[model samples]
Target: MNAELFLAPFLTGLGLAILLPLLGCYLRLRDEWLAALAYSHVAAAGALLALVGGLPPALGGIAAAGLAGAGKRLFARRLSGGASYALLLLGGWAVAVLLAANQPMAERLGHALFDGQLYFAGDAALWQVALGVPLALLLLRAMSRHLLLAHTYPDFFRIRGLRSWPTQTGFDLLAALVLALATMSLGVMGAFALVFVPTWLAFRRAARWRAGLLGALGIGVLAYVVAFGLALWLDQPFGPVLAGLLVLVGLLVA
Candidate 1:
């Protein structure tokens, strides 16, 4: 395999390997990690819809997940115990399947979305990650303190007569957009794995919040690089290879 062929894809995945785990730390802190899976699924559905409508799949995905993120507050009030996320996941899955079944072109893209097309990711994906990762980091850094307070001390804002909705809502939108971009490159379950596994291991092993963030980033990057190499050498799908490596790491850590 030519190294140049995969360089762009590698860099794109690497960016998400860093960014997703960082966001995962916050999602884990808030006990809202399920949002990753929900957003990815919805993004997949949106991409399929876009394919059918002759639009850019990434734009549709980001728009759909952004909407989902913005509406999270309303969903929280109407549904409890993460029910809203579950509904989104199932609904998205159903829509994606139906769209793919009805359109031959959509079927091919849908398979790519489900299994991951990282190796096929082009200049567009590279540019997306190039711009997105830094912006996301800046935003997260600015909101880090408020996020911590919002999650760890839910009543702190209330006591101070401050509304926490803005902070929470902003984070939700950020997560959705990031996950949508990731889903376009990494596939639904692959993006979710990055968000779930690294943070989970860090949560178990790290002694401090800062340490946990570092640990998750380290774990995600290491696994992603290794999986990328192994998949390229072994002629396997990147998504499953990455997920398997993470699970193996989890078992070893356990």
Candidate 2:
């Protein structure tokens, strides 16, 4: 294993190992865990479309997911809870498949989006994670209290005659952007697994909110490091290896 070649990708995954699980804590709190998968699917469709247009796939994915997050309120008005997220996921999947079938370039990008190309992640991905993670953390910190209040006490804002749309929409956009970056780096299912499994485990075991967040972050990073090394040693795909490891961990913890 060449350290020079693997370092950037390792760091990229590590950054997501931290960021995704933290966001997952919030998603689990809100009972909107499905949003991670939905955003990743939309990002996949956007990446495929970008490939067809000869644009940067990551950029397109971020843009598309961001749009979906921005429009989440509208979707919520028509369909509440997991239904809206399901709609986005199905719509995104269909568009991605159709685009991939029509374009050879898109087909290749689609495979990368689904299966992940984490081993090939370069300086670009590292930089994206480095810059994006801190910004996301800051945004999340600013919105943390509001999010907690909104989820724990649904009518906290309404009782005060305050609108929560800004906080909700802002968090949605943040989640979309972060998930797009994760999907581009870790693949759709890989990103979703990172956001889902660790948080689920932490929520089950931790007695307090802060403990849950830290536990989720710990679980994610540990699983990612193990998966990264195992994937390399066994010459396996990183995404499946990571997802599989998380599932096994979940079972053990359960």
Candidate 3:
């Protein structure tokens, strides 16, 4: 009965769930989906680093995120956005895989990246709560309006002549960061539902961005609650349970 263990991961996932879409919303406001692109790869690198390199590695991963963000901006102006993202994704994946293979406690690192066992409700990690919660809240506050705008109305933003690309870029960075943290806390597979499920529900039901976001948020929260319960009852992995709940929600709502 490790209470801290469960509490830690739950807090981490909750914080991440709130922060990621907020970041995406902000980036969309800036018309920079590419920013999100760079963040994804960078965050992946960061997660790998955190697992293997500890503090230094984690810092390096965060730094890589910034560098990648800048690179995406520069390349977007000069090259096709998809091409640039593809190159960066490949490069990032190569580096991350190499790091995972070489890092001194590689087994621990692998578990950190892939195992959902560490993040269940009853046995949460300390760092997940101590560090992740506050960071997520701060970022959410900083990017609030931009997120709402970006996710809700890109067309109106353009009509106003506001630069949505930069906003979107910022969102991408935040999304990656949150997703990275969540992955580290919950496992990579677990992160999938957080990104896709709510959005899917929104798409299936709502016509407006507001309605959609609301739908997603509601479904997201409900899915988490149900999935957590189901996992406990079945003695199964929480991530898959949560993901399944999302699928069910989509089916019922859609």
Candidate 4:
């Protein structure tokens, strides 16, 4: 086995383990976990389009998702509660499947699109992880007070005229960008697990937001290492292997 097989996934996992947990911690705290997953699927469809269209997959995906996210405020207003996001999630997924189903060549990208082609992650993917992880962390630290207030006092926030809508939109778009880039490494479902599972565990286990963030990062890294080892040992698919481990960890931690 080429060492790069392990090396690429390890680095991708490390980046996600750091970046996603910070976003997840905030999403978990704010009750917007579903929103992240919803846009990630949209990004996945965008990635698939990129694959078929011969564009840069991550960039194309990010652009498509950002456009959709920008309009989310208006779209969400038309639907009751959070159901609009559900629409986006389903739309993205269905379109991806439909497009892939028509093209015989889609199989080439399918393995990475659904199950994770972490081994094949290119230099572009690596760079995204390298740069994105730190930026995500910085975003979290800078917005701690604002995030705390928004989640804790949403109604009060509106009353205070705090100008949180732009901030909220910016965060939403940023999350879309990260997820789109992460999909280049982890694939769609693997990215979803990375985005949601550890944060779920952290939210349940830790008492404070900061503790939850730290605990989630710890859980994500541990799970990534363990799952990669198990996949290599068993010659199993990395995405499913890691996802199962994450699910089990979420259960155990809960």
TM-score of each: 0.97, 0.97, 0.70, 0.92
List model 3 lDDT by residue over 1-254, tens digit each.
66554665566566556544444433444444444444445566665666565564445555666566545656676666466666766676666667767875654555445545435433334454457657755765666666566567868867878776656566445555555555555555555566565765565667876666666666666667667667767878776777677778777777
Residue pairs clashing, model 2: none
Ranked by lDDT, top first: 1, 2, 4, 3
Candidate 2's C-alpha runs over 4 A off are 161-163
| Predicted candidate 2, C-alpha RMSD | 1.1
Cα lDDT, all candidates:
0.92, 0.92, 0.58, 0.77
lDDT of 1 at 79: 81
Residue 26, model 4: lDDT of 72
Any idea how many clashes model 2 has?
0
Q: Model 4 over residues 1-254: C-alpha lDDT tens digits?
A: 78865676678777886787678777767677787767777887887788789886677778878877777777666775778678888998887788778866555665567887676766667777888778867876877787788777889878988888656887777777777777667777777787789888877768876788888888888887888788788987777888999988777767
Model 3 residue runs over 4 Å out of place are 2-5, 21-41, 50-58, 78-81, 117-168
